[model samples]
Target: MCECKALPIRFDYTPKGKVEALGGDLEGYVVAGTKPAAIIMLYDIFGYTEYPQIKQVCDHLSAATGFTVAIPDVFRGKPWSMAKSPAKPEDNLIGWIQSVGSYAKVSSDLKLTVDFLRARGAERFGIAGTCWGASIALTACSQPDGVFEACAGLHPSLFGKDKEFAEALLRPVALVSARGDPLETVQEVVNGKPDLAPKCIWKRMDDVEHGFCAARGDYKNEVVTQRVAEAVQLLAGFFTSNVA
Candidate 1:
C-alpha cells in the first residue's frame, strides 16, 4: 500500500451543521444557502457522520462560496474507523466499499443527491471529494446527464490504471495531488487526450500527504487551517468559474 493511503489517528474537528434526512435512508450535514449552484461533497473511508473537520470544511465552503453544500452519508451510518477497527486499514476500506454496495450503486446514489439539490432550486452544481471520495467524484463526472458543472479531487484514490475513465470526464475538473500521489498515470491520461487538457487543472501539494485537508483537532495551530483554506480556495475558484 502507498504511504499516502494511511489514515490519520487524530479527530481534531468540532462538528457543525444540523442533521437532516436526504430521503431514501440517506442523510447529510447540510450548510443551507439560497445560491443557484450547489456542491456535493463525497466522503473518504472515514465517512462524514461525526467528523468535525469534514463538516467544517463543508460549512466553510457554503459560507465562503454562497453555494449550498451537502456532505451525504455515503456509508449510511456505518463509517469505518482506524482507531477502533481490528482489521488492517486497507482491508477495512475495501470491506466498507463493498458493504455500501458496488461502484454502480454509489454512482446512482450521487445522482440521487444531485436530483435532491436540483429540486430545491439549485441549477448548476459542483462536486468535490478526497481519497476514496475522489473516485466517486470521477464516476459522477462520467454520467451522461450529470448535473456537475465542475469537479475537484484531493489526493484521489481507486482510479485504476486504465485511462478510459479519465478520458470520459466532460466537465471542468481540478485534481490536487499530494507529494507521493500516483498522479503520473493520470497526467499521462490527460496528456494523451488533448481535448481534456483545457478542462483539467492539476495542482500538486509538494509538502503535504494525503488527507491533509482535514483537521484532526489535535493541534491548535495555523498550518492545518491554512492548508484547508488553500484547498477550499482552489475548489471555490473552479466552481466560481464553472458553476457559480
Candidate 2:
C-alpha cells in the first residue's frame, strides 16, 4: 500500500493574498493574473486557515509565473481536525476524506469555481496540489471533462493506486514525489501521459518528507526553504510554459 503520514501543524508564516468572493460558492484566496491564465491551488488535509503556508506557496507561484493563483475553501471552513496523525476510520481526518470521498465529489465543488473563473474571462488554466489535494488534481485531469491544460502534484499519496493516476493523465504534468514515495510508481504516472507524456516529469526530492512544498513545509529550516524555492521555480516554470 502507498504510505501517507501527516506531520505536525505549522503556524510560522503569513500570506499576502486576499480572500474574496468570485461568484456563487467561489470564495478563495487569490493573486490576480494579467495573462488571463489561472492556476487552481489545491490544499492538503490541513485546509488553508490552519496552514497559511498553502497560500504562501500560491503567492510564490503567482509571483514567479505572473499567473492568477487561487485556492478555494472547498472544506467551507471545516477541514481535517488533526485529531489523529496517521488517520483512523473513526478520526476526523478520515471522516473529512470520506465526506469528500472521491475526486468526483470535489470536482462538483471545483466546477463551481471553474465556472466562476470562466465567467471572469479566464482562458487558460493549470492546477497544483499537495497530499490529498495532489491525488485529486491528478485524478481530475484524467477525467474526460477535465479542463486544465497542465497539472502539478507535490507529494501525492496515491495509496496503491499509482497506476490509476498514471493512466489518467490527459495533459502535461509534473509530479514532485516525497522521499520514500515509490519512484517507479511516479515514473509510471508521468509515462502514462499518452502523446503528451514526453513533456511530463517526475522530480524526487530525497531530502524532504511528504508535504514539504505545502502546509507541512518548515520554512524555518534552511534546507526545506531551499527545496521549496526550487519547487517554486519548477512549478512556476512548468505552468508558465504551458498555461501562460
What C-alpha lDDT values do all the predictions have? 0.69, 0.75
TM-score of each: 0.83, 0.88
Report model 2's TM-score to 2 decimal places.
0.88
In model 1, where do residues sit more than 4 Å from their true spots?
1-16, 84-92, 159-164, 215-221
For candidate 1, what is the TM-score? 0.83
The prediction achieving the highest lDDT against the true structure is 2
Which residue pairs collide in model 2, if any? Answer: none
> What local lDDT does model 2 show for residue 122?
82
lDDT of 2: 0.75
Position 179, candidate 1: lDDT: 74
